[model samples]
Target: MTRARALDLARILFVLLTLGCAWLGFRGRGDEIADALADTSALGLAAALLVTLLGLALTAILWRRILARLGSPVPERAASAIFFVGQLGKYVPGSVWSFAAQAQLGRRHDVPARRSVTASGLFLLVHTATGAVVGTAAVVTGVLDAGGPRWLWALGLVAGAVVLALPVVRRDVGPAMVLMAGVWLAYGVGVLALLGPARAGLDDLPAIIAAFALSHVAGVLLVIAPAGLGAREGVLIALLEPVVGLDAAIATALLARVVHAAADFAIAGLAALRARRTGVRPSPGLRPADRRTDL
Candidate 1:
C-alpha cells in the first residue's frame, strides 16, 4: 500500500482507539460524571471553552513564529488552518503524526517540507521545555507536594531548554516563551473552571495548575499512548489527590479529557470552515516530499 493510504488507515484506527478509550474511561463513572456536569456552572464552562480556544490560538501564533523563523512565512489564516487542522493528528497513536500532518498541510501554502518539519519540531520542543520549567518551578516552590527529587526535575528542565536553545534564536525565544506561558496559564485557568463546581478551594490553585502542566508534559513524552490517554489523567489524579479528594480529582480529570477533545474538534472544524469560506487553497501543483517513511 502507498504511504498515504497507510497513514489514512492508521488515523482511522487511532480514532477508533480514542473513542474506545473515552467510552471505557467513563463507563463506571457515569453517575458521577453526570452529577459533575450537572453541577458545573454554564458560565464557567463557557469561560473554560473560551480560554481553551485562546490557548489554542496562542499555540497557532507560536507555530507561525516558528515557521517564520525557519523562513516559511504563510498568511495568518492559512497558518491557522494548517495548525488547527493538522493538530487533529495528535489523536493518532504516535507523536510524529501531528508533525507529519502539519508538514503536508503547510506545503499547500508554499511552506517547504524541511522548514515545516523544523517549525513543528521547534514548536513541540519549546512547548515541552516550557511545560517542564513551569511544572518544575511549581514543584520546587512547594506548590505541589509530589515529594523528593524535585531538584532533579528542575535540573533536567534547564538542561533540556539549553539543548533546545541551539536551534532557536534568542530574539524569537522571548516571544515564543511568553506566548507559551500564556497558553499554559490559559489552560490552567480552564482547569480551575472545571474544578470550581467541585468546591476545590482557591488555596490549591497553584497545585492544580502545576499538576495540569506536569500531566501535559508527561502526556507528550509518552508518545505511544494516543493523545496521552491514560497517562495525563493518572498523573493529574495522583497530583491532585492531596488537594481534592480522590473522587473529586478523578471526576475533574475525566471532565478535563472531555473538554479537551471538544475544544480540539471545535477549533479544527471552525478553522476548516473558515478556510473554505475564505477560499484559501493550496498553491497549484505543489507537492510535499514524502516524510511518512521517517515515521
Candidate 2:
C-alpha cells in the first residue's frame, strides 16, 4: 500500500482502539454515569458546560496570540473557527490534522506553513508541560485518585518537561511557550469555577491544577480515541477521584467534552460559512500566517 493509504489505515485502527477503550470504560461505569446523569441537575450541567466553553474561548485566544507572535495575526473569529474545526480531526488519529487545519486557514491570509506549524507545536508543548506540573502536584498532594499506575503520571511529567525544554535546546525559543502557559492557567481557572464549592482550596489549588492539566495532556497524547474521550475520563478520574468522587469527576470530564464539541462545531460552521461568503479556500498545507511580509 502507498504510504498515504497505510497512514490512513493506521489512523483508522487507532481511532477504533480508542473507541473500544472508551466503550469499555463507560461500560464499567454505565450504571454510574446513568445514576449521576439522573441526579445531576440541568443547572449543574449547564454550569459545567459554560465553564468548558470559556476554556475553549481561552484556547482560541491562546491560538490567536501564538499566530500573532508568528506574524500571522488570525482574527479572533477565524482563530476560533480554525481551532474548533481542527478539533473535528481529533477523531481522525495519527495525523495532527488539527495543527494542519489551523495552519492551512492561516495561509489564506498569507501565513507561512512552517511558522504556523512551529507556533502550534510550541503552544501545544507548553500547554502540555503546564498540565504535567499541575497534574503531578495534584496526585502528590492527593487531589485526584484515578486508579491507573502511578508511573504513568511520572512518565507524563518527564515527557512534558522534555518538550517544554526543547526551545532552549534549539537556542531560539519563541513566545509560544509563554503564551501556552498563560492560556492554560486561564483554562484551569475556568475548570475550578465550574466546580465552585467543590473546588480545591487556595493552598491546594496549585497541585489540583497540575494534576488536572497533566491528566488532560496525557489523554491527548495517548491518541487512542477521537478527542481523547475515554483517556480524558480515565486520567482525570485517576488524578481527581480523591478530591472529587470518581463519578463526579468523570461526569465533569464528559460534560466538558460535550461543551467543547458543541463549541467546536459551532465555530467551524461559521468559518465554513464565512469562507464561502468570502470565496476563500483552505491552503494546501500548514504554515505560518504572515508569509506575505518579511519578518
Candidate 3:
C-alpha cells in the first residue's frame, strides 16, 4: 500500500505489458518474418540488423537528449534500458503504450513523469517533422537520379534541413531534430541493405532512402496500426515498387519489419540484462522534486 511499493508494482506491470506485446507480435507474424528473412542473404540480414540496431540506439539517445533538455538527464546505460524497454510497448495495440511505458520506466532512474512524457511527445514530433523533410529530400534525390543534375541532391537535402532548423533555430529541440535526421538516414540504409547490389546501387540509395523516410512518416501519422504495421508497409511498397520492382519492394518491406523488430527486441533484452547485472540508479544529485513527482 506504500507509494514506493505501488510504483515498483506499476513498473513491473508496464514491463510485462511491453514484453507480452512483443511476444504476441512475434508469435502472430513469425511466418511472414521468416519468409522475409529467408529471401535475403545471410550477409544482407546481418547488415540490416546491424544498421537497424544502430538506428534504434540513436533513437534512444535522441529521447535521452530530450529528457536532458527538460532537466532530467539520466545515465547513458539506464537511459538505454529505459528507452529500449519502453520501446517494446510499440508492439502493443496503441502508439501511446510506448510513451506511457517510458514515463513509468523512468521512475526507477529518477526521471519525473511529466519530464518523461514530455520528452516522449517531443521525440515523436522531432522524429516525424524531420522525417517529412528527409522524405522530401529523398524525392529530390530521386528526381536528380532520374534526370536532373546529380549534384543537386545535396542542395535539396540542405534545403530540407534548413527548413526544419530555421523555425527552431534557437530552441532546445533543434539538436534533437538533427539527431532524428541522422536516425532516419541510418534506418534508410538498413532498408537499402535488404536489397542486392544489382537491384539497387549507391546511385539509387537516395531514392530508396526517400521512400523509406516517406513510409515511416506515414506510419507515424497513422496512429491506428500499432508500430505502423500495415500503413508503413503499404506506403513503402507503393512508393518503392516503382523503383525496386514490386517483388523486391515487398521483400524489402517485410525484411525491414523483421530487421527493425529484431533491433528493438535485441536492444531491449540486452539493456534489461545490463540493468539487472549492474543495478542502475538515478544520476548523482537527482532532484527531490523529480523523485517525488512520478511516485
**Best-fitting candidate, scored by TM-score:** 1
* Model 1 CA lDDT for position 32: 74
lDDT (10s digit) by residue, model 2, range 1-295: 9975775475445435544533443465666556655655566566555655655666666666665655666655556655665555665554476677666656655667777777677666556666775566455445555456767766755766676566432332345445445555655554454445554445544544665576578677886566676677676666556766666666656555544555555555665567546655433333545332221
lDDT of 2 at 159: 67
Task: Answer with 1 or 2, whichever has the higher TM-score.
Answer: 1
- Each prediction's number of clashing residue pairs: 0, 22, 0
Highest lDDT scorer: 1
Per-prediction TM-score: 0.84, 0.66, 0.82
Ranking by lDDT: 1, 3, 2
User: Poorest 10 consecutive residues of model 1 by lDDT?
Assistant: 286-295
Q: Enumerate residue pairs that collide in model 1.
A: none
User: So what's the TM-score on candidate 3?
Assistant: 0.82
- Per-residue C-alpha lDDT of model 3 across residues 133-156, encoded as one tens digit per residue: 776665664532333464564564
lDDT tens digits, residue span 102-135, model 1 = 8877877877787788888878888887887777
